[model samples]
Target: MQALLFEPNVQRIADETTGPITYQPGVIAPDLAASWFAALLQGVDWHESSRMMYERMVGVPRLHGHYAADDPSLPKVLGAALGIAKAQFRAPFNSIGLNFYRDEHDSVAPHNDKLHELVPHQPIVLLSLGATRTMVIRRKTPPHLKTELELEAGSLLLMGWNAQLNYDHGIPKLRYPVGPRISVAFRVRPGWSEDGW
Candidate 1:
């Protein structure tokens, strides 16, 4: 009976699993994903940020943008995408965070979603658009088991709340050339701040 839930490209990564994570491909259809990617790339105001790393301020490799779910300034594609996510996983996701990887040079260091920033027990919904990038998810404890998924455009990945406590995930810089990609991450922010635009 459970098998029926994940037909086609759905993958429930549980073997040697330390956390609950589900990945499904072709959620938005390829053409629509491409169109949405184009819209988000141009319509959204992307920005750069730096954080104190190793006792020095270092520039982040990728661009970032954040928004509230009901913000009037969000592009139409985001609303449409959010509708799909909510329909599939009924969660109280009130925040949206976007990461723009301009090229292979743009990468995020392995890290987990900060617990203080998210509401307890709420899942994190992630949608991938544009170029496919491999995400490395690994256990933070002994044995350090790892898994890799090539997040294709139109794919959706759900990480359970407990997953963050047990694992770390991120995209590493690729040596080969790759097209730009956008990652739209939906979360339930505990105490939301300003993110209209």
Candidate 2:
């Protein structure tokens, strides 16, 4: 994405007691985002896993990476990201969840972040890098409202803790070939101690 030339598409999808579910584009410049993406693509410890699907165990479509906010081994770029997120929402975010989509073949199943694993009332911040992908967020109740946003590199998406209670979001596999993408998710985890923000 051409961050400087790009027009900001900020949308507040919902307003809840905890916070607002919103998407803000071009939070980082394209040059900085490109460097960070390239470094993180090789820097983070990526993991692959499997999950039970239809009574059978199958590989998760995308790779995952996770880290505590205090760990000294985390990539420096992440610290920079944490500062941006903290400045934006001032929540004590202490966990990082990274999703790596290698290509259009990689995707994530529709689901919400586990409540038991997160701190109440804190918003979840996700920073996108690499290729753009559409994320579908659909409400759980009647009418099942659905919204789609093309998450481009350097954009930031903030979903309130309450939003998870009301919606499920996911990235479905695309038919056309696409490059890799990485999503850096910052959250506040219950009972976790962090040395820095």
Candidate 3:
């Protein structure tokens, strides 16, 4: 992966909210992404894990889901990544979730990180690898608003307290041909998980 340069610019999608919604570029250096991806891929035991859901258009179980973040090596990579992401975003992240999109067929639907799983107001760091895809962040309520971003390879997107508290984010499916893409979402889950640390 080559070094990626993010032209830091804030694009305000809507007004009368809390604060300005910012979309900063190149938060995650491509070199770090490359090194981390190599470690994540080698360390993770990637497997197909999908939950069946009814497709509105097709009215069928289209396996609308993605791979799980069950990787042993993740904790290590996450530990290292937290430092890098923190320096870039200027915040601390305690937990991380890894998602692997094997191809165009593998994708994630629109959803937010349940407030219960995360701190009341903390940042969620998302790092994209492999290929480019559209990452959509939207306001969950009326005004029916949305902001779309093309997440390129070896890129980092950080949604801080202002963005996390007021908006929801997700990566939607793509129709064009795409290769394997990995996204490691680093967040601050202030409580606990089944895996006792």
Candidate with top TM-score is 2
On the 0 to 100 scale, the lDDT of residue 14 in model 2 is 72
**Top-down TM-score ranking:** 2, 1, 3
lDDT of 3 by residue, 1-197 (tens): 33435564545444435433455556557677667777776676555443446743332212221221233434465666666667766665656667877677766667666767777667676777667878787887687577788877656676655655567766777788887777877777665444523
Instruction: State the C-alpha lDDT per candidate.
Output: 0.87, 0.89, 0.62
Question: In model 1, what lDDT does residue 17 have?
Answer: 48
Q: Residues 15-93, candidate 2, lDDT per residue (tens digit)?
A: 7752468999888898989999999999998999999989999999999998888898988999889988898779988
Model 2 stretches with alpha carbons more than 4 Å out: 1-9, 17-19, 194-197
Q: What are the runs in model 1 whose C-alpha is more than 4 Å off?
A: 1-8, 15-17, 192-197
Q: Compare the candidates by lDDT and give the number of the best one.
A: 2
Worst 10 residues of 2 by lDDT: 1-10
Cα deviation in Å at residue 2, candidate 2? 14
TM-score of each: 0.91, 0.92, 0.72
Model 2 has an lDDT value of: 0.89
- Please count the clashing residue pairs in each candidate, in the order shown: 0, 0, 1
Once superposed on the true structure, which residue ranges of model 3 sit more than 4 Å away at CA?
A: 1-21, 52-77, 161-166, 193-197
Q: Candidate 3, TM-score vs. the true structure?
A: 0.72
